[model samples]
Target: MSHLAIIPLLLPLFTGIFLLLLREQRIYIKRTISGLSSIALIAVSTQLLCAVSDGNILVYSLSNWPAPFGIVLMADRLAALMVLTTSLLALFSLIYAMSGTDRQGRQFHILFQLQLFGLNGAFLTADLFNLFVFFEVLLLASYSLLLHGGGRKRIRSGLHFVVINVVGSSLFLFAVGILYGILGTLNMADLAVKVAHVSPENIGLVKTAGLLLFVVFALKAALLPLYLWLPTAYSQTSAPAAALFAIMTKVGAYSILRVYSLIFGNEAGPLANLLDGWLLGMALTTIIIGSFGLLGSKRLRQQVAYLVVISAGTLLTGFSLNSQAGIAAGLYYLPHTTFATAALFLLADLIVQRRDQMEDKLEAGLVITKQKFLGVMFFVLAIIASGLPPLSGFLGKFMLLRAALEHPALPYIMAIVLVNGLLTVIAMARTGALFFFAAHAVDTATNTYIKQSEPEPLKVRELLPILSLLGLCVLMTLWAGPINSYSLETANQLLDTPAYIDAVLGKEAQ
Candidate 1:
């Protein structure tokens, strides 16, 4: 019954409602409210992380009914960790949004809060139906945010985003409905209970439902074939919007993590044996397709978008491995990707802003010729994106590779890893050289920012958010040890479902 369990969702929900009233008021007031709300969320998430780090599952029942009939919010180590990441990223994006003024401020902040609420709810929820409810809330806000400013590019891409997700939601609902029919419950923990006695043959129903549900999650996570909507939808939107979308896909990954490990693992289920064959095959195919897309793409934005496909594939690889080590690597890498990719996209937004200033023709090489600081940040991000050595990105890849090296076809597996690594490096290197070389060659961009370099040159406030995000990238690389250890714990908890089930229920069997 701790109040801390729900603050992540509540703060954003309250801020969103309040922001609606301030729609026509002063921007400062709206900014103040948004900033305050984000700060509040960060405080609460931090408190929960501290409180729950000792491996406690904080469960809250909605309206106090009980298991099968009641709605519940469950916060374990993994959920709390995700809440912390979501809160931090949201705070940075909100602060960035507030510092830069625009016509979209009110609408932007409102949708932003709504998105947080959706994410928090998804992470915290214990019921299957409730997860879908939160999913819709998250995507609905995303649709509006993507379409903000009503640009033609945004409009087309937003429609694609909307149509694809709508179909996903429909599929999610069908899965939920079928599960309810079979088990007579929508609560995840309760399903885990009733599933043990549900006759071996009827388990076919559960496995089928699992496949259908995986499709929906994969669509949202942007796995191969189903991920076509992500690139244009992402590239067409503004930086702030892209920052938020990056975290959103992680929610889908989280759902996949939860479902595979809990329902289909070695926890009294017929589906346990089937996970390797179906899931592993899908993961391998996703990697093959995603790596090809990464190799073929030339633009910075498109390259990153394809990498999301690759990350999704990585997630599936960990899932398909079906071992604690596999789960550990997947869990560790998932959040690392969330933070790294979010920061990278924010960096790219800054690059695009600067590049946009050049108007494609380069204005006689004046606009982009001499911005040294921007060049450094761009290269740093490129390295992070490529998953080269000594970065958090590399840590995840290394663990996955280590775990996979034991297979019979170890050489082929290593080659796949090698090829993917090379492709990422080459693609990122090419993008970096284009800008860094240009920056060094151009004498100066001082005169280009304005007709003349004034005494107090105007600050690029638009870049502050991007820099703040990039700063996080450096912090993650520096603090990789602590982060990876915690993620390891998260992965351990994910693979060992007994601890999770017990934490949610009573120790003495009530």
Candidate 2:
């Protein structure tokens, strides 16, 4: 069972290599292979999640070597859940791409699989250097994916995105080097143990390395000042690619949680709470900026991009509280926001495609195809995005707010969250009314022009992916209780440093 830790990483790795070997124009074959691999990943990840749900940590050491000296893959509740989420998103996004977007570029399937490979490796790796390696793998794939349906706008945004991430990768290397030099170990579990015993004089170096590491993760998570690159990059990418990118930010948040809780957590004498104040302040500022961006966005994809920023802010806000309850709330909120944002991005694409020349500009134009159905879908998604009643978003936000009340930053965080929610509602309402309700020119039966119009219905392929994602949101709402319970359990597991160390390095280490 412990060997199962490597399956998620390997599934995508081999699938990507196989995809690379296929003929470029063999769309059907590529789609079939990608779909099957995604399904298999979902199955494997679900099993892993179930296996680890009981507080078990499955660690696979490479070549029969021991921890702190050998490469290892570790899966607990948190990692398994992240893998499941990534697989779910990958499946639907691949389906959406098959609808037509895959034709926009060569090697779409290959890049998509490689992206998953990177994501799974990042989630499962127990070594810091391997984590950096996985980051590069994912970043490299993303650079190509961002330019998939090449356009001038995409090129510009992709250039900036690539430059920023490359710099971030450099910083990651520097941080890893500092840790390896000081601690003589890069395995996360070993680092956790070693960090607790660092001499007072050397503590400053460790803290410096930790802070630099936080900066890299922060850039990935799109925290406040570091988030400027995200909106344009996300908005300009192809929709399916954007939907997959939805999980990228969560990867950053996951890294922070995993690294901080294991290495610099409560057990790490002087390193504890080093990021609390900075994280809280940045999270609040991110929410404010995202809200303003939402209100100001002129394009549909751009608005959705800001919504991603808002989701990041909400997750980080919960995490910055640094309490078990707060962290659990963040974990619960993550999937809800991820699914909802992905759905919105796909919906934006559907609307844009149907509008012909109008695109997704949020202006009065040609009547959208499948107007009635899309109208309802957009309405439901709007409610979800705005954190309105009877959806997972509302419940997630409620949990975060409830948890925040106990924190000293409650006033600021709560007020900003509420205000941000209101702004989101306003922005979404404005967009919905423009796209669904605004009057458009129409041709009558007698061939005369009129000011009223109706839209064409959507194809099943395009509709399926959007509806599937929305369905997940509904399922998440219905299953919030068990899900939240699982989140709490996962959070407890993360905060329990001794158990993780002992699981990886054995009882003697603890």
Among the numbered candidates, top TM-score falls to 2
Task: Score candidate 1 by TM-score against the native.
Answer: 0.91
* Candidate 1 segments whose C-alpha is farther than 4 A from its true place: 99-102, 357-367, 408-412, 438-463, 507-510
Model 2 local distance difference test score: 0.91
Best by lDDT: 2
lDDT of 1: 0.74
Model 2 lDDT tens row, 299-321: 99999999999899899888888
Candidate 2: where is the Cα deviation over 4 Å? 442-456
Q: On a 0 to 100 scale, what is the lDDT of residue 241 in model 1?
A: 75
CA RMSD of all predictions: 3.7, 2.4
Per-residue lDDT tens digits for candidate 1, residues 1-510, read 886888888899999999998888887888789888888898999999988887777888779866657888888888998898898888776665564633564588888889999999999998899999999998899999888777888899998899889999898988898889988988887776666557776778777887888888878877766878987888777767776777877787788888777766677555664456566656666667777876776566767777777777777777667666676777777766776667666666656556654422212333344567766776776666677877767777788878776766456556766677788888777666665564432346353333422122225555666676667666767877787677677777777777766766555431
Our tally of clashes for model 1 stands at: 0
